[model samples]
Target chain A: MEAIIPVIITSVCVYGLFRRINIFDSFVEGVKEGFGTVRFVAPTMIALLVAVGTLRASGFLDFIAELISPLAESVGFPAELVPMGLLRPVSGSGATALLTGIYRDCGPDSFAGRCASVVAGSTETTFYAVTMYYGAAGIKKIRHTLFSALLADLTAIIVSVITVGLLMS
Target chain B: MSYIFGVMIALGFIYALVSGNMAALSAGIPEAAASAVELLISISGMLCMWSGFMRIAKDCGLTEKLARLLAPLLRRLYPDIDPDSKAFGYISVNISANLLGLGNAATPPGLNAMRELRKRSGTEIASDSMITFVVMNTASIQLVPATVAALRKSYGSTQPFDIIICVWITSAVALAVGLMSSRLISALTRRGRIWKR
Candidate 1:
């Protein structure tokens, strides 16, 4: 696992050399453009992070989780994992923090721990990805993207619990 | 996007107002701004490295070869982009990096792919292909879920990889749902002729 990236890098350079591609110049050019890409992505990311942070700090996430608890429970989903499921699609770091907390509170071998791991492992930060990709491309009207992404995120969370229950337990 | 962001902030601020958590909310704003910089600082290095290597790969025809190999399948999803084009090549590399659980490494190719798609479409509104691409990414398509496994291992789980099968199941389902919903909504929007953009 550790050797994979280095091997790929070396192979790309070697391949470039064999093809007479001037890998150094190519690399430098890409890096220069990457600097601009970072600059382009920063403002949206900062604004997004603050929005998510505000939501979390205001305890709205907990409120939403509580509101959804009965529905989650009726589906056999553990209430403890609701906050995690809610946060998974919005904030990657927040989901990770919740996942870690689950591991600590329930131990990784427990049902909630297993479910949390599956949830964390299977759900991407839909909001962040949509924002970054669309924002970078200067696309303002995202249309059905957020709708579709949230649907997928919901699927991941629901299926995580089901699959974990079936396989891990 | 504005509506979502605005709703998030507005609802949060309103909740804080009603619940009297304004101090914590105010503190989180700057903290999140700072963390955004921290996140960028961590990702930029890897982003540069991967983008550089990707450029080398592209120059040497590696990405083109990979794109050709993946084209039959990718073509079905992204019919707008020509199989042999740079956009397709970047899309192929992005998906491959994502499958390998190289999330940071995937971003450069993903962004390049988006840019290429945007250029090809020449539209400010996202095309079906771009929507499809972003949905695929947001579905957690990684095969191994390496970070999750590593976290489990660090927490003393003996069989960290045990959840690999479950991850696979959930990812495939999520991706399927995402793609299908996007396609469905796209068809509906087109039929209704509600494409204001």
Candidate 2:
């Protein structure tokens, strides 16, 4: 797994050499463009992080998770993972924090911990993805992307719990 | 974006007032800003390196070659796009990078692809292909989630990779559901004039 990146870099460099391209110069050019990309996304990132952070700190996320906990438990999902699932799509850092908390409270090898790991691994931060991608194009009307992405996230969360239960036990 | 943030902030403020959690919310605002900067610092290096490599790849025609290899699938996903265009090339490589678990590397190509798509459509609203591409990305289609495995190992899991199969199952299911729903909703809304910009 670690070797994949080195392998890709080497292959790309070798191919660049074969094509007689100025690899270093081309790389520098791309890096400069990357700086612009970062600048472009800075506002979106800051705004999203602040909103998510405030919601998380104010306990609204836990509130929503608690509100949905019964429905989740009725469906066989663990209560502890409900918050993680709710935050998974909206905030990557918040979800990771919850995952770590789960690891501390329930040992990492426990059902809840394993389920959290699988859920985190399987789900993308859909809010971030949608915002960054569409924001880049200056597209305001995202239509159904958010709905579909959240639906996918829900599927992943449910499937992760079920799969972990099936395999772990 | 505006609606999401507006509602979120409103909820946070109201909840804080109701629960007397105003201190935490007040402190969290600046902390979130700092964390956002930290996040950017962490990812900026990979973003630069990958973007640089991508530039080299484009210069050497590797992206074009890769695009050609994935032409069949790309054609199906983005039927309106010409396979030889720059947008097609970026989209193909972006998906490839995401599948390989190169999350940071995928963003440059993704952003570039969005630019190209927007330019082609000449509109501020997202086109069908744009939504499909973003949805595909948001499905978390990685083959091996290295970060999760490493975190598990750090937490003393002897078999960190054991969940790989489960991860694969969940992600694949998510991707399938997301794509299907995206297509379904798009079709349903196409005739109704319901999805106003």
Candidate 3:
């Protein structure tokens, strides 16, 4: 599946040449704009990353996980995966690191590992996506976006546990 | 928001003080920024490559073709969007990229589409079309879940794509819930009897 990336680029370029498009110049233009986007993204990303790193390094993430695990387990979410579900909405990298940790501590085919993968697949970083899109567009009000996004993440988390339990178990 | 950031940092600092881990607190900021730069480098590489291919797709009429193909679906989802607008075209490409599990590829066009929608609407407040577009982008279904696949493979999963079916099911639910909840909230909060879709 990862190989599809190069296949796509090749297909797009070949199709562009067949259509008599100026692919090189247009590509360069896009490269510059892409660079600009990265620049815009970097500051916001750094701020969020620092916050997340500090929160985890201070044991806040573990504390929250410890507090929430029993409640989550009562509702069918594995206690081991609670940190991931909590951080999934707030920090992509944090959840990713925790995912790798889970994979290391538990076998990948284990319920917890499969459930972690499913959760990662099913959810997007809600506040981060909103901040990037709306911030780039300068849309200030952001009305109803956060609420709906959080709901989506919540549903994804709940469904991940149930889906893995049904299919992987 | 800054509220979340400030609270996290301030709490981290206080927590470190209480727990006597000032060393970790002091090191976190610089370390985070360094890693953020490394992430920026990786993300920029992917974006740089895909953005170019996306431009080629646009220049060669692939985007227009894709947009036309998806027109029926787009129109149903965004009845308020102009049928002939550039916003619709970019929106199609964005959704296509999202479907392929290449959201970095989706970002440039997605932002462009947002700009176009805002321009057409001519208001600081987000229009129904913009809200619909945002929800669709955020909660769009992913067939491949490529990132998760790659991570699982790195961690020695024999069948990393096993979760594809579950990804499909969960993301579909996410899209429906996000879209419906946004529309419901807006409809409820609007002040007049003339609320239009």
Candidate 4:
């Protein structure tokens, strides 16, 4: 994997230069653009982070998790995995924090940790990503996009969790 | 916000530790820290790779070629959009980026696409083309899903590739639903001659 990284980088650089762009300039431009995006997206990202944090700290997350535990268990999902589902769509970092908690509490190889891992693997930060990208772009209408992406996120979580549970177990 | 939660968790652990809840704190902090590190690594890695890839793709003329290749399909999908318009190009790139499972990488392009779309949209609150673009972006099909694979690897999963089937299935379903609903809504408005007037 380490060896492949250089090869991929070199190939990409070579291809870039071949297209009339100076590799150095392209790198600089890319970085500049990235920083610009971070600036544009920072407020929303921070707000989401704080909101998720507040919820978790206030025990709202735990309460919701507990409420959903029974339904989760009926579907073979560990009750602890509920936090992961709730967190997945909101913020990737937030979900990772929750997953880490589960892994620590339940043991990495345990069903709950495994489910969290799978859920992390399958899901996308649908709402957050869309909001940040579209908001920056000044897009006022998303039509069916949010609903569709969310459906994908939900499906990915449920299917991945169940599949991993069955296979890993 | 979630940072507060992390702080709270840390405080709770501290409280637990002082209260002889050593086991809880001992178990929690390390896990939380590990997950935070993993998240940071994944996001940074993805951002780096995608930014680099986009630069390379643009320099290679791949971005334009990609736009050309996608033009026919895009025209069909977004008939209200002018073929020669910037919105068409941006929409094409955005859709392509999503399809490649480079949604994170696609962010820059998606934003650029939306800006171009907005410019072409005039003063309309939400043009038909803009709405379709949004719907497409939201329902963007992902074929690669590198972020998920990275997360799986971080979690010590041996079979990260197993997620491919599930990702494909779910993205496909979502895309179908998104496109159908948007088209239906657009058709209803057209028949009512609401936007036509």
Question: Cα RMSDs of all predictions?
Answer: 7.3, 6.7, 5.5, 6.2
TM-score of 1: 0.66
TM-score of each: 0.66, 0.67, 0.69, 0.65
lDDT (tens digit, per residue) of candidate 2 on B2-22: 786798789999999999999
Evaluated on CA atoms against the true complex, candidate 4 attains a DockQ of 0.25
lDDT by residue for model 2 over A78-135, one digit each (tens)?
A: 7778867877887776676567556655767888888888888888888888989998
Candidate scoring better on TM-score of 2 and 4 = 2
For residues B1-197, write the lDDT of model 3, one tens digit per residue: 66866888888888888888788778866876676566556556656655666767767877557656878988888888877788887888888767655566678999999898778766677777777777776564655565566557666788877777777788888778888898888778884445553
**What number of clashing residue pairs does each candidate have, in the order they appear?**
0, 0, 0, 6
Give me the displacement of residue A4 in model 2, in angstroms.
13
After the best TM-score superposition of candidate 2, give how far the Cα of residue B54 lies from its true spot, in angstroms: 14
Predicted complexes: DockQ each: 0.46, 0.48, 0.45, 0.25
Candidate 1, DockQ to 2 decimals?
A: 0.46
Best by lDDT: 2
Candidate 2 vs candidate 3: the lDDT winner is 2
RMSD, model 4, all Cα superposed? 6.2
Write the residue-wise lDDT of candidate 1 on A54-165 in tens digits.
8878978678767887987887887768777877787676576557556655787788888888878888988889999998999988888999899988888788889998
The better candidate by DockQ, 1 or 3, is 1
Clashing pairs in 3: none
